[model samples]
Target: MPRGKARTAATARKPRAPNLPAPFVNGTILKDLRKKEWKLGDEVGKGGFGLIYLAAEDVDSPVAQTAEHVIKIEPHSNGPLFCELHFYQRVSKPEMINAWANSRKLKYLGVPKYITHGNHTRGNENFRFLVMPRFGTDLQKIFEGCGKQFSKETVLALGLRMVDALEYLHENGYVHADIKASNILLGFDNKQEQQDQVYLVDYGLVLKYSPDGSHKEYKEDPRKAHDGTIEFTSTDAHKGVAPSRRGDMEILAFCMLQWLCGKLPWEDKLLDKNYVADSKIRYMEDIPALMRACFSKGESHGEISKFLTLILKLGYEEKPDYNKYKTLFKDGLKKLGVKDEWKLHLPVAGTSAKKSVKRKSEEASECSTPKKKVRGTPKVATTSGSLQHTPKPAAKPRQGTPQTARGTPQRARGRGTPQTARGRGTPRTGTPRATASRASIKSPMKGDSVNSPQTIKSPAKVQTVKSPVKSPSKGNNSKPSTRRKVKRSRAKKVDAWVQTSPR
Candidate 1:
């Protein structure tokens, strides 16, 4: 782990109850959270780190009738508010808040607007709290409402907006170490335009990637691996390196991939860090296979593959070309013939929905058919944890002692049976010879004669023997002789034959 960069897992430790106050009751007066005292209403949310309450201005305040806000209270000793405070303060700066928003034509950069922050003592407990404008439910809630997956168009739009948010953060030298659907909040309004507006919240895991204008170098530390959410964390993060610009983009790629596919490759291995890392590497090595595994065939997944590839190519200290990615999604929308509109009714019959219908119909047809009964010898059960099986003895020959392949009567051999031929003239009649299994057979020598019983040959052995042809001297530049060419051709045929033959 880098010096001064070690972070405990979010919510790993809870504040001692004696040092933290119990949940505030409705109408409890909170002092200094805003211009005047604010009254706590109902408990809105609770998390591993803290509790959130619906807060409104106290009756005496001039803006008492204003819209309600949310107050997040945490134990002063341990909570995410300290880290989040820094991010909110930086982003809320007048010149920085909308620096890129206008140019991008986004309604707003998706950060929760900061209201106020302060510390308070409730009876024996001292606590830290932050007040911010309370928005609608997070994307996780919406994802559940819409089923587990989002359409490609919806995911693309979300990706573009998140890229912008990350760009703003990177330009200011910060990175959102935690970027997941639950941290993203949908716009509060019921209107379609507002519904499409997405905000990136939860900055408790935020870290400065390039503090003092110097980018953080990549470092590999096993202890630090699995720093963030296991399912979507970047490979660099898995190596325990401090999160960087590339790490942010990599996390975003995971998010978009999950939203499109309904699950991530590492979701099943959430508790196993090493397995998740290995699975990520394997999937990345074959992105096309990854797409096919996650999505139905014939879907336009090339764009996502390209997007993920771009992130994979980025170096730890390198800044991403945000405009290039933004343009990529923009051009994708145009190619899909989607109009220049961010808010519109989604088609009831989408690609994913259609594929879902097809799958259900196929499943129904399969269920409607009856399965055929298989009649044959039952398979033998093997002992668990052992690969070897004891061979069952062959059945004796039927009826009146038939003649063996070697012209011997079956009964002539005492306490012995006939052995099968090895693609040869005759079978042996005696105690079975200890012939090598075909899989264990070695290549026959050139002088060995297959017709003779002593020189039984296996199908073909693929030994990677070097060609006997010798190159002419470098300075001579002479062509090979006819004899050498003939030898080379023969060698090629033997090589091909060896590879094609059954083991």
Candidate 2:
């Protein structure tokens, strides 16, 4: 086996993503495209190396509304030309084929459609520009705009699909160095699937497996370059050790943990798990998964902790048998009185082509426009430090507002955006809100928003007369005050239903 990393069994299933020529402004190709009459429109997205724009090129005439395209323009500098041309020239219809393959499904993983690429020149410079379809929203933007959560099932289904995509890439001998919510595209294909399917974007750092079996990998190998964000990076990457499939798994594990728990693994080994494992850290990565690495109140509790435990257990070294998990899910869902819990048939890859899937309640939640208030389990608040200001109500709806618009297939709701500014007006990139505190809902920015109030931020501050609140069973904050009383008079009202649910 090549020393690098083995693509997990999952990634090898799909075709390699096409490597189209990256474009740039003031390039010969841009001039050529200008000659071809491709007019640039608004800026679509940004990358450190290039800028993506929405463009329209007249096929027949400049006046005619032609096809809209996402054009990529790399920054001009002294680097490469022929090598760049060769790589982009190698790009082809694989992207087109990918688009065709996913056109029909409830494709919520928001990836832009691939169009074409070409050479161009302008203002004493020459470079390449590539084109693709356009839909302009990311998970980050969606969370900023909408704080809605998917059903529990939506989170699971979407999580599995993301793993599948990663597996497909790995199988093809490539590793998505950066895997995070911002990198995951949304609102590109289906307006609704933005919340369902997560599009994996920005493959610039992707490591293509070297053909020679001598490529580097994790300690098992030694030459691999560490590439990825420090926050989500794996133990091997941190150690300057080679990378392998486990590296990706570690990153994947980190992403999953962040989704459910709101923080990175805390144990000191989390900082250098592979290094420690190679030394005397007896359990290797096991401790980090259990939060034995570090312990902070925020990182260790709330709903995120609850589900992350389940996911971590799923990743144990001993091959996980999801059958029992599925069984437990079946029973738990049944006990929760989930309706329409039936089997669905899906097309399997090369068999007689039949697979059964269960349709859970969260699917309906995605499509349920008229939403109901869920008296959820207590969670941590993203805005813990600030006192919630009683701002004047605006056009935005409450968390319980029904979403009649159907998002893609059911996904797990453990994931939501945390709109905290790291103290600056500039917001931090999305963080998990599965257990967000109530005080965090201070922001008013608009997004097609995909997150919700499902988080367990602070139970002490958020609940009101309109919605039922679950008191911490044994926290120091609990008191026999009027706030704890469920009953409210006309001067303040209370609900009788509070007596039934497990308060």
Candidate 3:
């Protein structure tokens, strides 16, 4: 074999070691390329190939728990950190983010701003580290805490934010290949003004689709097949095609779907990448079927369905309409009676209470107004009179009953026909008359002169005697009356009430 071929054979024979970096001692200081020193505190977290430490500007005192920055360290041999560092250096500077937000007239953007990064030597081992603004718990943890599902409003709001971030990345000649819940984080400080903000992190898989102001050609490489999270990876990724703007949108769509529905159709078969890919392809062809599979019978989200449909139609090299995508989510939020206030509506990290309580309280306040109005009306008028009698013609002119019931009994009596009919007669003539008429067939009240007119007007009143028997509890007497005229009038009112009450 030639020398080059022998070198390649030897390189292939060597096994690659894992890229986990050794933990650094507390209070350690390191200088970046710019000569700015950062102090490392306790080890806050660890990922597959790196460790995260709370960091602050080099100071005489130790790093505090409230340090506003963090350092991510990985072995020098690791490729992920190297790739991420390059992406951040080239595209995620503070000036870049601020300019984009200002140009777009946005209050804020979700892209994580890169700080300083450099090489570090601990013991005999070399490491690469990057400094970034510290962020709170990621969306994955919140998603799990929320029973693996988010409300429709929250999902749309999050989707809109993600689109804004991805659009910025795309415009900067890069694509975030991995867009999952784990990579999206909320603001670190719990300040009320910033609580609504979220930052997208973990740029290890970031790819530059347009390095020279020209989109990359569509092609597949078998060596890079199935390169992302199986459950949410785009169809092109499964086929080993290079990542593109459309692929990012497709991944985001899957993420939003999972957030809204709690799970994906291919989630159960994630281990089988080929099956997951096939499932996604199958669903993409029929968006309604996909919606039906994820949602319960007779339930569907038009916004989600439309989003998926638009994404499925995108070509491998197509430039996604980011504004169109945002419109779908914004419209969805409106339909859900929500506005894009940037609030996440998720549970706070390390707490049993949910952040969604504020939203729920707002909804409760809105609904409470109508309840107060309902309660202001007389209980008998709303429950017994309006609810039971308003549907009938005979009861149409008795609107004064509910209004009069709110005033003194004297006002109800002074209202004349409607008021006196409801106030005095409701207790005795309304209920007891029906009860007595139904219980005993030989009762003289049936043959009494007071009931003679009701019986003569409609034979239907006789058949409905059993109906009013069910409504005996609705009657309430204010005062006794001995006037034969009042008794006679009460009997006639009772006939109307009994006819209208439900059986």
lDDT of each: 0.64, 0.41, 0.71
Q: Can you write out model 1's per-residue Cα lDDT over 213-236, one digit (the tens) per residue?
A: 788777666656677777888777
The estimated TM-scores of all candidates read 0.64, 0.45, 0.65
lDDT measured at residue 344 in model 1 versus the true structure, 0 to 100:
24
Q: Rank the candidates by TM-score, best first.
A: 3, 1, 2
lDDT of 3 by residue, 107-153 (tens): 78999888989999888888999999998878898888766777787
**lDDT by residue for model 2 over 308-409, one digit each (tens)?**
344444422232333443454445445545543332111122232121112345566666644432222122122322212222121132332222111100
Ranking, lDDT, top scorer first: 3, 1, 2
Q: 60 in model 1: Cα distance from truth in Å?
A: 5.4
What lDDT, from 0 to 1, does candidate 1 have?
0.64
How does residue 397 of candidate 3 score in lDDT? Answer: 24
Model 2: per-residue Cα lDDT at residue 260: 39
Comparing 1 with 3 on lDDT, the higher-scoring candidate is: 3
Q: Give the TM-score of candidate 3.
A: 0.65
Count of steric clashes across candidates, in order: 0, 72, 0
- Scored by lDDT, the top model is 3
